[model samples]
Target chain A: MTIGLYAPGASALHRLPAGVKLGALVAASLALFAIPSTIVALAAVPVAFAVYLSTGLGLNRLILELRGPALLLCFVFVFHALAGSVEEGIAAVARFAALILLASAVTLTTPVSEMAALVERLLGPLEPLGVNPAKVGLAIALAIRFVPMIAEEYRQIREAQAARGLDRNLLALVVPLIIRTLKAADDLADAIEARGIET
Target chain B: MTRDVSTRDIVYIALFAALMAAVNLVPPIQVAFLPVPITAATLAVMLAGCLIGAKRGGLAILLFVLLVALGLPLLAGGRGGLSVFFGPTAGFILSWPVGAYVTGWLTEKNWPRMNAVWFFIFSVIGGIGVVYLIGIPWLALVAKLSLFDAAKGSLIFVPGDLVKAIAAAAIAETVRRAYPLMQAAR
Candidate 1:
């Protein structure tokens, strides 16, 4: 199963090299803060949405991406309004919201594998520093692989806790979760060892 | 314990990193008017350190952070990517690996006499003290709020974090008695 936010499309955004898009993202983020004009910062939000929309992702998809940060954006506005720095608040919110939109755009358009490859390549230069880029990439893939398993374990443990009278106790919930996480890790380790995938 | 990261160590790191992602799916407690909600994901940071040794624990969290930056919706409330780096709580988010590292380092140092109290103390020191050390200043700078103002909003997370520290401490002691995962790495 496809585990991430990647939504396939043939749009220019989708066809754009993952590394270039990521580089643009990093550059744009730096520029957002480096520029002092709040208006310029706020203006970038629409541009980000435009890029997002160009991916054939639609306005609804773009708006949905904003839902999580929307609350925070509102709070940011209100906090700054109270502090008598509404313009500053708007700038901060705008910068973050735009970045969020752009990020989602990148993730949705780019396949996880492509992104992983980009990361590995980016880390390649650090190999001399003893950073094993391939291992790091594999670890990331393995971590993603483990997510569904861990979520299942979390659910089972929560259910088990509820079955007893210990549902409300934090320790009851936490202790077994930790134990099971370790157990799962141990089993996976033994499997990897048996497979002789040299570290 | 050898300097080389064995296959077991890699799996442990990956699993804990996965644990971070999975924990983010837990329902977050939204404090009205507060941008960042209280989350179990942060508790997982403590668990990463308290369960795994320093090196792997820290690396586990570092791995998670890299994935988050890579645009995975691995954070609570489904927030991730470069967007989070620009957000007000970016400081706290970035501090996860450091916090985990400190917690694990302290845990390792006190392993011989490990108990709930030591676990709690280390978790608090690393998870709370170290995290907010970076998080608060970042919040203030990014949000253009005064230190006092930034802290006022951030203090809300403290009560919940303390509770998580307690849970981590309890789990730490229980794991030590029942199954010490860190021992294998050592």
Candidate 2:
């Protein structure tokens, strides 16, 4: 449920360079998907779990992060079992769960700013192509920062609607939510301009 | 084709991205009669496309996807990360930007003159039509099912999506009327 998956610690994974962690994730994901063996995929799951355990966030945070994916994994397994073969089902679920756990591990260890820096570095080559990687990185940072704010706003709107007994009205709920959100966006735009971010 | 992205535009994109993420915080509406669960996040995506024009709308969704790929639990029910890209729902997730783009493009065509009917038509075309076009095939491939079967499986989403489209159209019209700045440039 937490947006910022980074868990503070002095673990080796936390110490790994953001770029390296990202690169490893890409490589590992590719490798997992490229190899179609069920046994290898199943083996990767424990390896991923072990790496996640090494983060020292304990099982609670891991489970919280994994809860949604676990539901999805069930659907995948069921679908594959019903529509495909048993081997295929295991292979698909294992590969998916393994990749998810590994990714969550990386996120749990790496801070968002580091990730943004990595993104900026990766996009550096595109400067000549007229791409502003800083802008992209800033956008990502802003999104992460504002996600909780928006979530809060949604809650506030819901509460307001409920107070007025208009909660059941879809239009009553959606209209004000959009209007208020857009108003918030306008204020944010003013704030950004005041700070002199490139137009 | 090149336009300067103002700080305002960047803020809009970020906020819309946040808005999409926030929509997920709300529990999904479950229909007692139907086995499928309907999420409001997709409606936020459609509303975003209609609110901002195509380029900005698409960028908003793109930024959201990038955050998701980087392992932010922003998707519905706090789901995120690269593993989502490999799942059966990957098609729908990946089609988000294209769907937003198409919806925004259609909405922009009639701009100031657009009414509820136009909004409804454009929203459904972009939200339901474009998303389904790519999503169904991707579902079939990832789920290893026949195209027809994939389409059949997707039917459960239709009633909910149509309702969202209608809501989007009405909301778009209201915003366009209430705030002139929200309207497309003629």
Q: What Cα-based lDDT does every candidate model obtain?
A: 0.79, 0.76
Question: Against the true structure, what is each candidate's TM-score?
Answer: 0.89, 0.85
Q: How good is model 2 by TM-score? A: 0.85
Candidate 1 CAPRI grade: acceptable
Q: Which regions of candidate 2 are displaced past 4 Å? A: A1-3, A148-152, A187-199, B1-3, B26-39, B142-149, B181-186
The digit string of per-residue lDDT tens for model 1 on A81-130 reads 88998888888888888887887788788877788789899988887777
**lDDT of candidate 1 over B1-186, digit per residue (tens):** 123777788888888888778767655434332345535566777878888978898899988987777667777757666567766678998898899989999988878888999999999988999999999988888777788877888898798788778877877888789886657768
User: Lowest lDDT 10-mer window, candidate 1 chain B?
Assistant: B29-38
The top-ranked prediction according to TM-score is 1
Model 1 bad stretches (over 4 Å): A165-168, B1-3, B26-39
lDDT of 1 at B110: 77
lDDT of 2 by residue, A46-164 (tens): 99889888888889887777787677667656766777586887887788788778878888788766776777889888877767887887788788888788778777877887799
RMSD of 1: 3.5
DockQ of 1: 0.47
Clashing pairs for predicted structure model 2, backbone only: A199-B5, A199-B6
Which residue pairs in candidate 1 collide?
none
